[model samples]
Target chain A: MRPLIRMAWATSRRLLLLMSPLLAFYLALMVVHQVTKRGTDIPAIAFTCMFMLIIVSTFQGLTFDVEGFMASLPVTRAQLVRTKYLLSFLGLLAGLALTLAVAGLAHALAPGRAAAPTPEELRSAVALALVDAFGLFAFLPFVHAFEPSRGILAFSLAAILALAASLAGWGLDGAADLFRFFQRVLAQPAPALGLIGGLLAFGLLSLSLSTWAYARRSF
Target chain B: MANLLELRNLSKSHGAFNLRDVDLAVPAGTITGLIGANGAGKSTLLKLVLGLLPLDGGEIRLFGEDARLGGARLRQRIGFVQESPTLFPLLRVDELGEVVAPFYPRWDRATYRRICDAFELPRKTAFARLSQGSRMKAALALALSHEAELLLLDEPTSGLDPLMRRDLLDLLLEVIQDEGRAVLFSTHITSDLERVADHVAILKAGRLVLAGAKDDLLESWALVRGGEELLEGPLKDRCRGGERTELGLTLLCEGAGSLASLLPDGALQERPSLEDLVYFHDRGKESLCAR
Candidate 1:
């Protein structure tokens, strides 16, 4: 196996081991919800996003404890970093796949419905998943690379709080205006272009900062 | 000939603890034991050599390659085992070797299998569930499997039982029998070093007190037993810190060849053991005040 792929394999195997139980729980929840009248795609998607966020942070943050072991290896720090990024990207992809599969299956197998996701809804789901995963992914390296220890936890908690605040803001009258603005942006190709641009800028900027921090870091 | 590992004026400071102008060398084809008291800079020095901790003020060359500036290529030739075995918690024993094999071009699967058999490690056991000795052996197995020329072991035997310690040391000796392989093992167990170390370096309070051939150190430093007057008259300066007796004083100092002329006729000089030399050198002031 290639070195990076081997590292990813090791990482993914560990991830599976840790998440096996959670995966079981997720499956059970989907099964129960599908059996009951509770017909919704949002639940599965939410669970996946939350699982991705938690698992990525915990597993990626693991490097702190294993710094000694990683140093003992013949691999470079850059390889280690690249492997972690690849593993996380794979994880996000896995989560996205799970969400799509479960949601599609539930919609198809529902008691009284034969509804499938429209093209627009499919595009929206993909867009939302990418936005959520990439946004979290871009920010997490800064958490692990620069923050170290309690720093990541603190940043993550603050992010969770911000997300909760955003949800609460959804109840306000201004939330409708924000949603209308969002719809307008989504209606045109300019929004997608803008999102991709912003993501690129943020991803590169944060990754560069992380690389600098790691390069100069002791251990 | 260039040594396998060399540290020139390596210095690193940790607030209260400081390793000052540390210079160290380990020749190829020899096992060099690093002995030091707790809180000494043994771990710090090992970290510098491994590039785990950055050097504050010096240079380290491994296999004649500059350590501080070394890239992945240099690391491929070196293997490290930490005091605590930090294997991936979820990885099974058999899976570990495979996971680590890709990083090194010269990784020897056959040798790894041999080490596993010799160590009696179970292939299916998760690293987190293994006992301390087993965990250490697993780490050692991974390190040795890489066909690395230089092995830097930091207190690899710290938590092992006597039997396990013997097994580990025996494996190390066997590994280094190839002559080109060299090891710098930092350990507190002097007896283990006595068995395998061709050269020993003693670090005390973050400084080297004695470093040379094991036999030479044992031969050069001797234990002298004499009365107070005998200790005061001619052997005072020559007397190293040692135990005290009511009728006389026991001191560890330079061997009789160096101090025989200065000692009184009644004082007896005896060869010191490796442990005794370490005890004397490490107890710096306490050994001196015992008199």
Candidate 2:
């Protein structure tokens, strides 16, 4: 367990280092948006960066030679897989905290033009991020089974397709209706709890699949 | 003497290569040198014993317990140094040690530091920044610090300068002198083994062709050089492997006493080295195929 935690910390440290440049870019964009009094979608931008971080970090964890080295140690396959998930979870929390801080700074800087996020908006952002983050988390095991570069390519393709679907959703009446339904669900506590529950179950299922694949891997 | 490691009917196959029905043992307090050609399944056998690769068939018993059932706990008692250093390149040497130390219950920080100091390993240097020799030394330090009973090293001496190789071999000898520790290191460097290995196992094309006490193997096999006519007549069946030159035929044969009796007084009978055994064994296979 200590080994796993140590691995998680190492992974998280690497992930943060890799994400630093992109984080700087996002911060620059936020500052520009604040000074110009432009209406930037803060939550959406934060979520995108979070998703990218997760993808990049997952790719790094799966592709590193350290995985083989770790396997040679007295650590089990299950523990290795679990450490990956733990890293992703920790990265998510860190990313969200950073995003929140950036959004707060943007609001504070341009108090007359930009408004602070409402409590309801914060709830929706948190709930939506959870769903998106866990949805991506579910694919990590499968991604990990691939070569690191290929895994990143695959994740990038999936992310692009998802972006395309979201863009295409604006054209579909049923999609708008679904968005309205989500807004209503986010306003209430019960359905939001159900959504979070469903996401957790799906994430766990993905984790189990990853563990099975990793356990059977040759190295 | 009790066997520290045992393999019975072990088998594994990958594409055109197959390691078939291998049965071998290493007694406690002895260094067993696993020598073979480039594709001779030496690494495959070590990986199998380490449980890095799942077995296609057979059983591996270490410390009188099934290796598969031994799980992570069993692995804790065995240390391994791969042909390439497998430590994380991004981490400093000290950080890599910290990351790996918690996995083994018997990890000794003092020993790790001692080895690092002796090896002249740069504790603050990232693995990627270290020289190949330095990385190997760091790897040795980690493997030794765990207090493992059995050390399974795959080509630990490869790529090192003669001085470094000798140093590592000396360290291996020092480890086995404890009487509770045993080592099985695979190498193409026969001279290194000649200096230290008590038991030698020769693998040829995935098969354990010859294995025994190193001194006994040297004593039993003789390198015979005699006339080609002698090879064709008296030594035809006796010669393990030979090539006919214009002057004579050089042959590696078993049973030195028999060869001395059969050969003419002009024929040369010399003691076989580990390299001689491997060369003749490989040539023997080629000749068998040609026939």
In terms of lDDT, model 2 sits at 0.79
DockQ, in order, for the candidates? Answer: 0.55, 0.57
Q: Give lDDT tens digits, candidate 1, residues A93-183.
A: 6666676666677676774552454555555555555555555555556544653565467767766776677779765333234434444
TM-scores of the candidates are: 0.88, 0.89
Model 1 residue B211 distance off true place after TM-score fit, in angstroms: 1.3
lDDT of 2 at B112: 92
Best by TM-score: 2
lDDT of 2 by residue, B1-291 (tens): 888899999999877999999999999899999999999999999989988888999999998899888867788999998888766767788887887888888999999998898888899988889998888888889999988999999889877888878888898999998898899999999999999999999998999988899999999998888775555456666778866668767888889767777887688899988899988887782453254
Q: Which stretches of candidate 2 lie over 4 Å from their true place?
A: A14-22, A35-40, A52-57, A150-185, B285-291
Candidate 1: tens digits of C-alpha lDDT, residues B27-91:
98889999988988888888778777767897888888887567667888988888887877777
DockQ of 1: 0.55
User: What fraction of the true interface does each of the listed models get right, in terms of native contacts kept?
Assistant: 0.58, 0.55
**Which parts of model 1 are misplaced by more than 4 Å?**
A31-40, A43-50, A53-64, A110-114, A134-139, A146-148, A157-187, B243-247, B285-291
